[model samples]
Target: MPIDPQAARLLAMLGAARPTDWPGVSAAARRDGFAALMRMAGTPPAVASVSDVRIAGAAGPLPARLYAPRDGTAPGLVYFHGGGLVAGDLDTHDALCRALAAGSDCRVLSVGYRLAPEHPFPAAAEDAVAAAGDALGRAAEFGLDPARVAVGGDSAGGTLATLAAGALRTRVALQLLLCPALDAAPDTESRRLFARGHLLDAAMMARDLADCAPGALDLADPRLSPLRDPDLAGRPPALIHTAEFDPLRDEGALYAERLAAAGVPVRHRCHPGMIHHFYGLTGLVPAARAALADIAAELGARLAMG
Candidate 1:
């Protein structure tokens, strides 16, 4: 299927201003640039309330933002933003968090994990585990039931969410992944099919993998690539969302298959004619909005199961 019309237009617009040499720019500049672009694409949807707080991290206090619905004491979701583990922060994903909180009627805690090249591999993963633990540990203070908490994110953040889920196991009710880059090895057919023209190209992904795992760290390590984990039997139920036109599409599908094979409940959906990062484009694309609503419904249902 061809890309959705609105999505195609977005791709064209992004291509027109896309950076030619990402490695040449400083990480801070790239972070700022990405945030500005997201802001220009659409205005954030309003929520009942948003507050900033710090959570205990492996390295230090991790800055986080909380989005609460109008009602009191709802389920909680620990969210991480996507930027290949190199860019993105709490501000970059503020709008998406607000939308999720409003749509799912759940409190969302968006964690600002340490980035790569500076903190390197396992640093972000460690911070993710710590933040999730903290969220569950302090669920009452956040007006959430500890047993109803879930962890989720998009792209690289999705990878982190999976790692956190594996580490926390049944403690987390569900795992929500959107266009997740689960495998460090890009040998899948989708990687070749959508390698260049799509918003996420092969070259950029390679750079991101290298930055996150500098030196001789094995890319196949389960901490670095959750799909490589030897055991997925005890992991939480999963709702995996993938894009038909995304390079990581096959891997996300494969991960779902693995989970199901390991006896874990899995709900996987591949959005036709969609590309990576479409979940955040809810304001500009009709498909994205629909997808967001579907995700919210699923999250709400699964969390309510307890």
Candidate 2:
């Protein structure tokens, strides 16, 4: 599929903000730049209430935000934000969470997990698993139904979600992933086809891995690349979305196929002509708003069936 015109324009606009020496840019600088771009999410859709909260992490208190559309106990989601495992925070994805919580009728707990080059691999993953467990154990305090809880995220956060749900399969009600980087290094056609032009280029991804895992970390380890897991049986039901022009597209598709083959209930979609992170660019890609709504509706419907 050809790139969406809106997405193309967005890429063009972003091209100006990209550092000329991307490979040489420090992780701190990269994170700051990414934060600046995410600010374009603009004013978020209002939820009934929003507030800062602290949650249990693998090692300590994890900073987080709570977005609730109701005053009483409700379905809940433990969410992580995407920034290549080194960037992003609760505020960067505030708008997206508001929409999900309001539209999906779920209380969303947006987690600010530990980042790379500081805490490194397994740290964020461990925090993800812990946050989900903590949310479930203390659901009442967050005004959530302990029985109806999902784990989800976009991009790198999606990666964390996978690890968390896998570690807590029987407990998590659902898994929501958007344009997730499923593998550290996958040799899929999409990886080659869209390697250069998309917002998340290969070089950027490589840098993310370098900083994310650093020394002695095996990229092929299922802990880092869940797709490599030989068995997908009993994993939580999943709603996986990928972008047509994303380097990570094929890996998501393959995972969906494998999960189904393993008897796991799952649904996957590749947004035609869309690029990575398209769902979060609704302000620019108007059509992407409908995609997000579809997610909200699906999320609500699936959990209701529980």
Steric clash pairs (candidate 1): none
| Model 2 bad stretches (over 4 Å) | none
Which residue pairs in candidate 2 have backbone atoms (N, alpha carbon, C) closer than 3 angstroms, thus clashing? none
The residue-by-residue lDDT of candidate 2 on 1-306, one tens digit each, is 678998899899888778666679798898898887777665678899999989999999999999998888889889999999989999889988998998898899999999988988989999999998998888999998878899999999989999989988998999999998888969999999988768888888888888889887778888789899888899999999999989889999998999999999999999898888887787778777878888888898888787
lDDT of 2 at 21: 60
lDDT of 2: 0.88
Cα distance off (Å), candidate 2, residue 260 = 0.5
Computed on alpha carbons, the lDDT of every model, listed in order, comes to 0.87, 0.88
Flag regions of model 1 displaced more than 4 Å: none
For residue 262, model 2's alpha carbon misses the true position, in angstroms, by: 0.8
Task: Tell me each candidate's TM-score.
Answer: 0.96, 0.97
lDDT of 1 by residue, 205-263 (tens): 87777788878888899877889999999899999999999999999999999999999
> In each prediction, how many residue pairs overlap at the backbone (N, C-alpha, C within less than 3 A)?
0, 0
